[model samples]
Target: MKPSFTFSSNSIRLSYVSWICIFIVLLITISLLPIIWRGLEDFNPSDDYRLPYELSYDYWMFSCWCKYACSNYPIVMIGDSVVWGQYVGLKETLPYYLNELEKTNQNYPLCANLGVDGIHPSAMLGLIKYYGKSISNKHVILHLNLLWMSSKKHDLSDTEEFRFNHPRLVPQFYPKIPSYKAKFPQRANIIVERYVPFSSWVSHLRLNYYENMDIGNWTMQYPYRNPFNAITFQIPYPEDKPHSEPISWIERGMTKQDFPWVSIDESFQWDSFKKVIKLLQSRKNKVFVIIGPFNPYILTDESLNRYKAMKKDMENWLKNEGISYVSPSDLPNEFYADASHPLKVGYEMIAKELVETESFKNWLDK
Candidate 1:
């Protein structure tokens, strides 16, 4: 008879260790993958000011920086991430352009950026009522992003492309936004609370002191895709088709019909829009309400036919409200950095239009 040998305890433990190693290796491999492959890699600046999870609060901090920087100036620009340009420095930003133009050609005599990325429109009303006391007499260029119209609360974040990337930095700084989304990843974001790696801290330091300043698009992807100059986007609607891939923000595009007309009697959004207008008029300052540029998604080929049919009704209700609004749809597509965001070229076109407009000239004259 042969003796039956049982497996050794060490053998079982060794097998378990091997499985653990396999799992860890898989995680690392997944994390390093390019965004092109649905990998969970971050495309932030390599050196690190990347708080492990700072993107969420860092944006508002940018707004706070503007609040601090603008105390000396008179004109203020206010809105969402389109105003921030994700990875760009503050000086090369919109306010910086206004400042530079004023210094050279003297366009926006004393303009400053009061823009807050991710700001809600209702919050904007409160902000204007509160912080806008000084700027009331000043001419204001308000970019009424159509995305806000689709929002339930009519706030910027409630719009289609809402993203809450990092929640950890919230409690440390903006407790309000973080508190609302507490159901999000709290424990994971807490990792950022500890010491940020040396490389990460320098990320913010390097970009903040960027030598040139003209290079603006920050959410740019490199390595796989070719070096893109600008990114542009149209508006987003409820999609019947699932997203086949991540958006291509670097491409140039256009939209025929922006702001799909929803009847005031049919829904509350129309009424709320009226409230937003009321809030704008409530201000004592000259308001230059602008219909910012959009990519062509605002109208599908079918939707375009519908928009053309309803153009008369839509215009009568919204366009004739004595608002100094202009749609840059007539401008070239290369003007955008992404859907709805104007790149450097687009900003110049916008500036040119502002200079030419009778309303803008009148406001500047005052």
Candidate 2:
């Protein structure tokens, strides 16, 4: 005869409640851990500081940076890798040059670099909306890189799934991206992380300490190594040297090519950029735009003509919106690293032009 074991209804109910209580306690503990850990660190960022290149995808670190910048710096320069100084070092970036130019002036505001690599217009919108809550009532310099509009693929308009940078920062559900191929669970996880401090904190640990691997995989890779040993509590510094040699496009063997430019009226990236402007404005930010000194030396005549027209259309919109903007003249051919990014000397030239512009002066005064 087999012995039958069955739990009573009351016992079953009690066990269910106990499990729920355990979950609640675990959630609270995890959430509080990040707060406590962050408090223990004595993080004091210096001038010309930017997020470490390795931590570019760590939104938690970015959020903490945003709060710090909001508290200390009055001017924040936000954009893609152009603002991030892709072809140059941290001290050679646009924000650093801006700070240097302002240092001689009376009552000059300190500028902070809030740029992220590969963050196009769409991702920029999501980043500001979710992680930049502390960026209110400050002067924000937003860079517009027309390179994203030069092709459907870069603009995220191609009807194909391809990986792009900062996938978690883009819209997860509504207004789907054709190039993004994240599944439902992945998308859901990203959305949850944006709203959950603990998830992002865990991601920060994975990226900065665990060689960008999850605990399960990391443990498997180093079976005998203690996981806690990886947490050295030391933050990495931003790469001080350029990713590539600081040279002109021509020196790099880049020749003139025709770019299939998209119309501004139907461009997804342009639309997203406009939304970014509106978001900043809604937060009472004093927004100033910098239209690219996009290198015309790398464009075919026809492509250059199209680019000029597109630039004109963009200028017209800025004028109509009454937004302060500067479209500086192209730097010397040798100053450009590519069609968009500028070399160290190029950034210095651009900063000089910006500081001398009447519109820029007026915006800064305001």
Writing each residue's lDDT as its tens digit, candidate 2 over 200-278 gives: 9999899988999999999999999999988887778787998778888988999897998988997889999999999
Model 1: CA > 4 A from native: 1-71, 87-92, 105-109, 130-134, 150-274, 304-320
Clashes of each: 23, 0
Highest-lDDT candidate: 2
How do the residues 152-247 of candidate 1 rate in per-residue lDDT, one tens digit apiece?
A: 333222334334423232232331331234443554444332233222222332333222122343333233432232221111121222112223
Q: What's the CA RMSD of model 1 in angstroms?
A: 15.7
Please report, in order, the local distance difference test score of every candidate based on alpha carbons. 0.44, 0.89
- Cand. 1 Cα-lDDT: 0.44
